[model samples]
Target: MAYGIETRCIHGEDGITREHAYGSMGTPIYQTATFAHPGVGQSTGFDYTRESNPTRSELERIVSSLEKAYDTVACASGMAALSILLELFENGSHFVCSEDLYGGSVRIFSTIGANRGLTFSYVNTADAELVEKAIKKETKALYIETPSNPTMQVTDLRAMKALAEKYGLLLIVDNTFLSPYFQNPIDLGADLVVHSGTKYLGGHNDALAGFLCSASKDLADKIRYIYKTTGGCLSPFESFLLIRGIKTLSVRMERQQENALKIANWLKEQEEIKGVYYVGLPEHPGYEINKSQARGFGGMISFHTDTAETAKRILERVKVISYAESLGGVESLITYPMLQTHGDVPAEIRERLGITDNFLRMSVGIENGDDLIEDLAQALKGE
Candidate 1:
């Protein structure tokens, strides 16, 4: 019988597999560089750390189960996983991608992908017609990031999937924002799902890891071969941390989402706040579409302050929230997109996306709701 997400978060493949060697309560870290073989003709499942490790394999299995993927490959970082995923296509291949994406992703596609003779066209994938118009004869895939980075633009996954099917293109989704507990794009017809495990799946600020979960076995086999060949695998220790973090994913997301909704509503009522971009809010442009596609609106929020000075003041004055770049930790983090996450992005595109000096992105944590609001209130006072 299929288990619920909360149960999966804690138990994983516990009774289904003899994964733990000693049947330990926690997944043991196989902290060795190599494993021994019984004989020349036979072997253990693992050979070298670069190829595989029992600890990492167990984490991959757990993620695969959560995602309902044919297979999942864990990598050193989100960028590494994205780099490997890009390798699947040949030279001169083209892709239609979400316009409002993470700055790092835009950097990669414009530089490394461009250098490799790959081409990409960025469009508002939330509008299926625009995405369809961007497709070319050379297009091999439709790449999307829903509730897109910092700005919170939600895309229609099923619509994108239909476009991909109609055009014979692969549908790849970055599910990092919602994680597996709240959203599974594979179930929505995405060919592959990507995650920055360092964020939600890791659930803490401690470990760094990435994952690429494939819906098709053929796609899984291809990426697995590239993964081992490229050797950007996750460390056994980090894998152990991710496994521990994932155990608390359901609870963490629940509290975070609750906090985010309250904060977004409060932001909307503020005189100095110009706008709030959070899917959880019913007034958000993509709220209904987001509701149709995802189980939750997630904890990420981006808002525009009345002035650049007000934005700066909050960054300096906030006592409860930390001024940081990374998100999805137990601690709430507020970031300046233009100065931090989107600094590398071109000025024109940044401006078009409303990532200005007055814009602030926030990642709500499992903290006291009233305390967080009070902290914000104090920070925004007299602004």
Candidate 2:
């Protein structure tokens, strides 16, 4: 049988044992911003904090081992990691991306990136034919998000990988939601995998960090160059905290997954719920592909209520679930796409994508299942 998630949580990357250390259970935080050289014109170890540090190296090794990648580089934020990845391609290169990516990513691509000679086309990547037709000779990368935001549409990674190989295109996947604990994109043939460690990997939403991992040495080198030169690397102190958070990732994720499934089922049966979107639900369109790639359905679910008015009232009344945008925290959060996460998305595209006023997204937490269900029920009650 596979190793249980709890075991992985506790000992996933604790390489050094008590015999090697001073019997301290926790990894020490190296908070210094600079390191000294042994002699003039000679570097003994880490020379500067920006290039590398002991704490950050430990975190990188742990994340790479967990993700089953050859290399991993941590950054100040998820956006910084993405920006570094994009530097690999030259200006005027075309990119094919999914229509429903994270709102911040979409904003960067559409607004800030447009002036850099980068052009893009957003298509429903679920349809292999559509993706095939969108590729141009200038296309350099195909960026995608599985279990896409708001709509929860899952993309076929294996199929996309095949297409990328055939077309000489780079495949980049955002594995933030499911995390390396639940899924490893490198195993599925992706060229590069990105994560907002601020989410599940950090587990408590206490750190702002990002990571990019790859199985290829060349790709890893390219990413490392951007990471060091662009100067957006994560701090040593934050890396230490992230390593601490990751020790409990598997257990926390297991609880969150259980909670999400329970809430999804309960919401599906409610009369006020117009539609529920979760890969675990048998009726979901992405079920088969998601099941093949992921060990389990992740802890994110979105649903549409009877109307926008009802959604507004429920959001205003929910007691346990906070109305927040970021996810993967111990406490649950609810967000409205059109007004929150996807607020920057154009009105026309939002309507076409069914990110209507009635839609609500729930980032389920490791809370008592019954209590969470009751909160939703009462929030939906007509007063």
Name the top TM-score candidate.
1
Report lDDT (CA) for all predictions. Answer: 0.92, 0.86
Query: What's the residue-level lDDT of 254 in candidate 2?
Result: 87
CA lDDT, candidate 1, residue 299 = 94
Per-candidate TM-score against the hidden true structure? 0.98, 0.96
Clash pairs (backbone) in predicted model 1 = none
State the displacement of the C-alpha of residue 12, model 2, in Å, after optimal TM-score superposition: 4.2
> Model 2, 229-343: lDDT tens per residue?
8899999888987988888888788899999999999998999899999888989999999999998788999999999988998799889988888888888999998899999
Please report, as a residue range, the 10-residue window in candidate 1 with the lowest summed lDDT. Answer: 13-22
Model 1 residue 334 distance off true place after TM-score fit, in angstroms = 0.3
Candidate 2 regions with alpha-carbon error over 4 angstroms: 1-9, 12-14, 17-21
